[model samples]
Target: MAMSDVLDEGPFFHGTIADLRVGDFLAPGYRSNYRPEVVMNHIYFTALVDGAGLAAEIAAELAGGDAIPRVYAVEPTGPFENDPNVTDKKFPGNPTRSYRSSAPLKIVGEVKDWTRLTPEALEMWRERLATLQSDRRAEIIN
Candidate 1:
């Protein structure tokens, strides 16, 4: 299938239900409740412009892997954080923001902080770290 078509299906909404792993897309707390635009915001801010690597990760995440865990998909959204992809949705814990990172497949992940981790910013960093980890894991999976 075409890459765009898979992305349209959604990171969690792939053609095959088995292609999606029900993992935590966000961290917990204020960050846990971020809109998809927020994640996308970081993507642009972090300059995550590589689609080749991301696409592969989505396929792996959809396959349900614990070792190399990560969500993968081409961020179809241009440069608009408010655009809201598909992953931008209120999860169970955090319900204050939207979701982003709409892919044909994704990996479930736990949230954790980076070096400067605080109670307030823990969720933020956690999701960030997890996304990075997910990205790396996606690489391995691919």
Candidate 2:
């Protein structure tokens, strides 16, 4: 499947069912109840842009992880705060972008298993991240 088929905009979100559902995509904000270690608005979604990485993330957050994790096909409606693609820890927590959806995000579907990413998928993900990073840099430069 094409990355555009699964992704609506710049990138998709890889997170637990509860967090995604609870977080308001319409007015995306920080989670008050997140783990103490996590910053107030440092929401870490995936830049994986594929099922394999998404499923792995979902399983990691859940107990047992027997059931499939939900994948949120979200668009980066606003400017992203952190750079998950960046190796440097600009912030104390995991590198993630804090985004507010410009439009309503849709629940694309669930990843049933830890699917393996095809070579094409991996390449697409890398390219997409590069584009996003470049866009962010442009935004800063402007």
Candidate 3:
């Protein structure tokens, strides 16, 4: 079967520290949330609300101080592909439901009801991200 056939449809979400309103466009060329040193070529998002929540929490933590984590319902304006960082390198498939698009993603609305990570869970994610940051071999597939 073709990989695209198995992908979920609709209800995409994006997580970030930036406060965005409906109709805002999220485009490429911004610094990556996972690796700030690299400017991203594509905007990343996921099909799962919880996945977006996790990303937002991490991004907020990284931004530090008074930054709010936010998840938004979004629509891609053009074609998107599976995020190779997870799909090709780690998961061997699009299990994360992560995707990237060179085109802009339009914010449809904010999602306020997604589950938030507990302090311990957040800390664990922090540690994991820290380890990845410290590892010279860990690279974001820009």
Candidate 4:
């Protein structure tokens, strides 16, 4: 489906380990958080705050540093499409509310009150990601 056809009004969020302030623009061309070997062509965001939180946590863990996970309220400066990585690939539709854009995402504010995963849940996710990373068929549709 074309990106313009999908209608969603979002108070969107982007999750990461990078510390950013309001008015910052998150652009594409960075290393993939799930597969660091690949440079991403699109900047990803979600309408779901907790999904972004999970992404942030995973990114922080993968980076293996003292950095804390952060989620920021964002606005896409241009058109976006459903994230093919998850949409229809894993779920039938966009239950994840995830999207990607080649254009920059402007940060409106930092989201400080999102729920955090517990240690056990975090570990489970780590294991799952590790397995996905190791599987040869689990390619990112970059």
Which candidate leads the pack in lDDT?
4
- How much lDDT does candidate 2 score? 0.41
List the pairs of residues colliding in candidate 3. none
Q: Which stretches of candidate 4 lie over 4 Å from their true place?
A: none
C-alpha lDDT of all candidate models, in order: 0.28, 0.41, 0.90, 0.92
Ranked candidates, highest lDDT first? 4, 3, 2, 1
**Root-mean-square deviation of each candidate, in angstroms?**
15.4, 11.7, 1.9, 1.0
Candidate 3, residues 53-113, lDDT tens digits: the string is 9999999999999989999999989888888889858987788999888999999999999
For model 1, state the Cα shift of residue 94 in Å.
Answer: 24
Q: Which ranges of candidate 1 are over 4 A from the true structure?
A: 1-68, 77-79, 82-142
Q: TM-score of model 4 relative to the true fold?
A: 0.96
Task: Write candidate 1's Cα lDDT for 1-142 as tens digits.
Answer: 2233222222321111123334423221221122311222222111122222232233233344452322233222432222222223323422222223323112342112112224565455455645755563332110
Clashing pairs in 4: none
* TM-score of decoy 2: 0.37
What TM-score, over all chains together, does every model reach?
A: 0.17, 0.37, 0.94, 0.96
**How far off is residue 96 in model 1, in Å?**
23
Encode model 4's per-residue lDDT on 1-142: one tens digit a residue: 6766555788999999999999999999999988888899999999999999999999999988697999999999998999999989999888899999999999999999999999999999899989988987999988
